[model samples]
Target: MWPEVKIVHGKPTHSQSQGSVERAHRDIEEMLGAWMDENKTKDWPAGIKFIQFKKNRALHSGIGRSPYEAMFGCPARVGQASAGIPHDLMNHLATEEDIENLLKEMEGESNDLEDPNSHGEREDEENTVPETVDAVRTESNEDVVCGQCYTVLPLGEEVNNDGKCFNCERQGNIVNERKRSRESLEKQATKMLKLSKKKFSEVQVGTTVRVPIPDVDRARGSPRNVLAVVGSVEDGLYKLCMCS
Candidate 1:
């Protein structure tokens, strides 16, 4: 189906020949395991689809862009899948617009509360509660308000010692986790590259080299009997042509 593709077979058990494919397989396995554990399901076939969706949208460290964006030449557009869910069950599924409007409303109420000119206005309206105040009062009876954002959390939901709701706490944790993961990955990659540099030198085109024979082919040839000539080099990868 893909006419533009050129297939080159790699030697069996030679991961260096297909490092990208090996890495992708490792990532997919990790994601699939996490998905299955989160959903409490053993059916990995169903989880693979979700894993693929997430992987394509995730940013690739080497490419510096998501695979979906690289292939489509645009960023992937994601929709709110929880839009049809009931608000009580999925209260945390607030959209960007909803959050923005809530922030604006809170800022306006804060200004109203602080203004000395509004003292007479508040006294005049003492019999009638403001909409924001009424909303807070209504939610406080059934939910807990976050100390940081004043967002109402569902009853029985966990809150941090500092009174931050689950959503706020999760967001903070995710940011910190991502920062630590990125730093660790960068350090590991740098160390690996430094070690590889000391072990291997650059190969030039037309240079004859002895490549290791795969285990499956070892019966027919020596371990390092395969001879090849480097044809070209691009992006630190060498294209080699097998010699008879």
Candidate 2:
């Protein structure tokens, strides 16, 4: 019983795992040019661009330092995280308790109304009717904020912490429901504004693009010949200009 079968063992010319490698190589070759601006700059080594192309094809790095690196052990730069969270997200990360107190003080308050700086004396309800109490309650009810929708929902749709609204319909996760006040919503509104401002801040310094104007703007009903500088607000929601 020396040898039962002919043992064939020699250096293989090509790798047995070559199929996947060839397919991957083809795909990478196709994607190897014009995808590398600042956005793809982290994949600089394999990024390719022609003189005609302002940008180059980018490569995915999944092992060096970015999420790609951590997940795949590849050497690629991490994509930007701040892109999803609005630019001013840091300022609005308040606790639930703080939001609740702020809403009570702003209930039924008109947009132009001033904040009550001093605690005024309580009003006497000696002659107050049930209807008046109902109205007051109705007005105050407008202050609650829906964590899902973020903004304070309509009065009739205001949801409690259980995530059930006044109409008894649930808008989101009951467990994730929040008890934010109008004041908190207002603060969020300001942060939204700042976030929007930061979005416009990306317009290159002293550079401009033909952006659409809002009908409610200075050149309402007419095309606005305005600067594209910071805060030169454009209404991306509409097609205002003639060429827009």
lDDT of 1 at 60: 76
* Poorly placed runs, candidate 1 (over 4 Å): 1-147, 152-167, 220-223
Q: After superposition, how far is residue 226 of candidate 2 from its true place, in Å?
A: 77
Q: How close is candidate 1 to the true structure, as a TM-score?
A: 0.36
- Overall local distance difference test of candidate 1: 0.74
Query: Residue by residue across 38-133, what tens digits does model 1's lDDT show?
Result: 999999999887788898889876555666655555556665432333345346646787655655776898899999999999887875657656
The segments of candidate 2 whose C-alpha lies over 4 angstroms from its true place after superposition are 1-13, 34-244
> What TM-scores do the predictions have?
0.36, 0.17
Give lDDT for model 2.
Answer: 0.44
lDDT of 2 by residue, 1-244 (tens): 6577865444334454696577766665555544555356657564544321211113223211233223323233222222233334425647655444545444534332443542231123334555775797787764666555556554445567666454343323221222222334567668878998787654433444566544344333565654343334355432222322
Candidate 1 colliding pairs: none
- Cand. 2 TM to true fold: 0.17
